[model samples]
Target: MTSDIALSVKDLKTYFYTNNRCNKAINGVSFDIRRGKTLCIVGESGCGKSVTASTIMQLLPTLSRIEAGSITYHAERGDIRIDQLARNGAEIRKIRGAEIAMIFQDPMTALNPVYTIGFQIEESLKYHTDLSLKEIKKKAIDLLRDMGIPMPEKRVDEYPHQFSGGMRQRAMIAMAMSCNPKILIADEPTTALDVTIQAQIFKLMDKLKAEHDTAIMLITHDMGVVAELADEVAVMYMGNIVEAGSVDDVLRSPKHPYTRALLDSIPVLGQGKKQAIKAIKGATPDPYERPNGCSFAPRCDFATKECDVMPDEEYISKSHRIMCANYKAVS
Candidate 1:
């Protein structure tokens, strides 16, 4: 692992078991989150972005379990390795809030409707910090005020329902940042908000990152967001990562066909003669029925008999990689 790696996920496989059959939700996914940088996980819906994030945070449901892989956290205590599958509740509890903090996709649902925003933020501080009640309250308002909430002194007393969707999202940011964690895992943080508000949230995150040097793992489907915020990008399809690389390498010159298709599907704004975006043809295959060879072979335009042999990872220099037989052959 690199000296600056804050978190390293190696060959992660999280599966769900039922009486009927077993399902693979995250298959052999791996990436590194470096200190003080952003790594964006991008894919269409049901691509296992949330599952990967939840697995790392050890928040998956009882039915689903981590089948393989090692999550290693490098800290002052040295490397803390956990087999996310076998970790006890107490161990997960320590890692969840103290070192890693998560911001959910929906603030309204994640935040308790009964509690005031101040109470929620203060609660996080109280759990993680040994501050007095007065200090916690002051920090809570400072967090809200720092997130640009208007009159945070007054609004901190308001409930979740009282704030607009955007404000609620900002308040969620306040709560997530209250502990000043080393790693912030945002699972679709800007999903429901409008574009302008989405922009603001990202800008705020970027500002905070610079100020605190926090490592961020952003899980989302938006390529624009990936282009804007990420230093590196990981593309997942049907629970498996097909490509991973630096943002400039992956976005500007994608080796995998799936990555190309995803970027091509985004509609262009200023090209005046409006035309429909070219979307990928097939829906993601069922998790229980994933293909035997390459998971993305069914949808790839460049797939071949080689794809039926199960792809292998090919390093395109030190910074770019793709799990594809064809891209390796041609590139």
Candidate 2:
């Protein structure tokens, strides 16, 4: 809605239709990513975090469709409603991997094994720009170098398998950043890496953001990662954003029960006594069989009869909001 907002997703509902049953993967998801800031989406597995990223990138599979809502991208040219762009059409093509890029969860799966890493990076540049093959190749190697790959001139010519996991991840980042996209969507990019490598990846992303002023939509379940990079955090549950605010507001003064539960579950360093780790009770509900009312009401400790109907989104502050009936009582 504002010039500073790079991307805004409003009430997005992405569903999978199979056997006449609809699996609501991302129901009523909304958030804003501002230019040069990182917005982290955090939740447990199957909470629709990754699906939300895929939807924003217009990368949803055949069975999936955006059933409702809008994804608006604020470009230098003008404001564009991405949801209105035809799937995989020329308009969407101009945005995906160019103006808006995504780094997927697994580089091995996302990268083409048969193609050299340089070719892959160049492919994006070639598609989006009118650069010559030689220019694209030179830019590709430069991107890899920027990503901190050793001797990127040599490594760029190597295939995905030749590089280590960390290297491959870096290559993926290089490819995503090749076009200097306005928005970068990274979906659990550090999921398979060790703590050290994960830290390195985040640091690289932070450096990229600083240099490029890129708005980042980071989808991760790790609270630690969220702590490291997020300016704002959105805690999603059962396809709904139950809590959202500045990182400190959401992490330190979380009002929603779900947010509190999530924070309490994170294992702390030097946590004094030998107490068992805290974990949220109950599993995520089945997507196809989501219950009426609050999807988390079944597991919420403070659920009331009022929870049988989804509560109105209550603002704790201008930037802090929660969709819980008992937030006032709990906080």
The model with the greatest TM-score is 2
lDDT of 1 by residue, 18-70 (tens): 98799888888889999889999999888899998888888889898888888
| Candidate 2, poorest ten consecutive residues by summed lDDT | 268-277
Deviation in Å, model 2, residue 266 alpha carbon: 2.0
For model 1 the local lDDT of residue 311 reads 78
How much does candidate 1 score in TM-score?
Answer: 0.96
Model 2 C-alpha lDDT per residue in residues 103-134, reported as the tens digit of each score: 99998999999999999999989889999999
Residue 323's lDDT in candidate 1 = 89
Error of 1 at 282 (Å): 2.0
